[model samples]
Target: MGLLSVRNRFIEKLRNFATLSDPAEAALEAATRNASKLPARRDLIREGDRPGPVFVVLDGWACRYKILPNGGRQILAYLMPGDCCDLHIGLLAEMDHGIQTITPAQVATISGGEMDSLLTDHRGFARAMYITQLVDEGTMRAWITSMGRRTSKERASHLLCELYLRARNIGLTDGIELVLPLSQIMLADSLGMTPVHLNRVLKELRLSGTIQLRRGSVAIVDPARLAQIAGFDENYLHRRLRPAIAG
Candidate 1:
């Protein structure tokens, strides 16, 4: 696909959170013009690396992760098409976690100056960016809740539901089916499960006719049933843009 089209996907995501004026859209277009292609399983950024450009996913998937002392990796967040890695990461002295591509991907690296201009000069863009960060925090809270309180099966279901909705939000889904592009190892790491245990949970979900999994895709056979199992609520996603707060 053309770079313009890919960049439009990022614009589409921002539009979910705030109305972007024409100049704001043009600034984003200019800021994301420099994109690089990465192969699957490549590290985009490493822990302790000095912050550089803000990375935006143009296509394919990437993840935020950290390696534990025991050498195990914990996947923190998935970066799908149009998701920005961190709008304010430039302020950090060094990265505390790593980011890696899960599939062959296209990522745009926006320089700190461009990012600062967007945040300082464009009110709508700034609001959208801030709201995106808030939504990211909300997602982290939900993941914490799942890890600390949910059963293995519930965790699996909850994650699938979240992925499905997120993909749908960014126009990545076709009906109830979406490309997952994640390995069992990746999923297990994200869900805090052994691959063996995750396999069992997936089997049960399949047997219950809640979902159908293929090589790189999953079909939600019964989304309502799946949501019920996970106690899924879309509110945490904060899908709509609310009125801006008055200073």
Candidate 2:
């Protein structure tokens, strides 16, 4: 695809929740001019590596995770198309969590110098980036709440809801259906459940008319009911901010 299309994806992602001025749009497009395609299940950035360029997902999914001493892994966050890897990670000495591709992906690497110049010269874009960071933190807090207090059923349902909402906002879904590239094991790891238990919960949701988990896709049969079951709150997503739309 062309660079303009890739930049448009970034614009679509941020414009879902925040807006940018014309200068900001032009800067982002220029800065993200060159992108590389990444194969599925590859490491974009690993734990303990020196911080590298900021990654912006142009297509497909990636995730943040950390490996435990027992060889287990916990998935901290999911990065969808148009979602960026942590921009501030460049400021750290070493990465605490690793980012890896969940599917074949297109990624743009923004060096610290480019990012600093963009932020310094474009106030509106900087504000949008800051808001994006805040929203990411809010999502992490919600994940903590899910892990700490939600039941297994609620936790799974909440994650599905969260992913659905996020993908929908970025125009990745049609009606109630979207491609869920994750395997059962990945979903289980992210939800703090065993594969068996996660399978059982998914079966339950399927049987209860909440969702249909087919191969490579998830279809919410009754989003309202599912959201009620999960007690999902969309306030933290913050989909509205003031700025002019750019071409």
Candidate 3:
């Protein structure tokens, strides 16, 4: 795609919260111009790393995770295309979690100076960023609720539903199907379950005809039924504005 079209795509994401003015578009273009194509499994930021540039996922999947003292890892959230990571993290000295790509991705890095410019001169863009941050916080809250209250089957189904809805919103889905690049181990880590247990859960879902997984793709056969099983409420994702999914 052309540069203007690429910039417009990023602006479309911000427009989910507020209508963008020409100046806001220009500011986004300035920030988005420095994207680098990163390989899959690359760490964008690491725990205790001094915070610097903010990252925007222009394409592919990435996630935020924390490592426990026992070397166990918990995936906190997934970052999708049009999602910006840590919009205000530069204010902090270091990151408590790290961000890594699950697939080869085009990641745009906006420096502290550019971010300051957006806040100082582009008020609309700044407001959109604030909305995005609020949505992220809401997603985290929902994830915590799922872990504390939902069963393993419910947790996995809920995650699948959330991701499917999000991918659809971003035009990444073909009908009810989308690429689910997560491995069983990664899904288990995100759900706080053992890999073996996760396998059983997937088998059950498949046997019941609730979903299908093949060649790194996921198809929700009956989303309504699956959502019912998980007791999932999309409201927590803030779908009225920019809808996002949790990991």
Residue 26's lDDT within candidate 2 is 76
- Clashing residue pairs in candidate 2 are none
lDDT of 1: 0.89
- What is the per-residue lDDT of model 1 for residues 1-247, given as tens digits with 9 covering 90 to 100? 2333544678888887888888888888888777788788999899999988889989888999999999999999998888998887889999999999998888999888888878888888889888889999999999999999999998999999999999998878769898899999999999999999999999999999999999999999999999999999988889966635321
Q: Which candidate's lDDT is highest?
A: 1
Candidate 3, residues 166-236: lDDT per residue as tens digits? 88877787697778888999999999999999999999999999999897988899999999999989887
Worst 10 residues of 3 by lDDT: 1-10
Give the TM-scores of the predictions, in the order they appear: 0.95, 0.94, 0.93
For model 3, give the RMSD to the true fold. 4.1
lDDT of all predictions, in order shown? 0.89, 0.86, 0.84
In candidate 3, how many clashes are counted?
0
Q: What is the TM-score of candidate 1? A: 0.95
lDDT for position 46 in model 3: 98
lDDT of 1 at 196: 97
For model 2, the superposed segments whose C-alpha errors exceed 4 Å read: 1-7, 244-247
Task: Sort every candidate by TM-score, greatest first.
Answer: 1, 2, 3
How well is each residue in 154-212 modelled by candidate 2, as lDDT tens digits? Answer: 99999999999999887788698978999999999999999999999999999999999
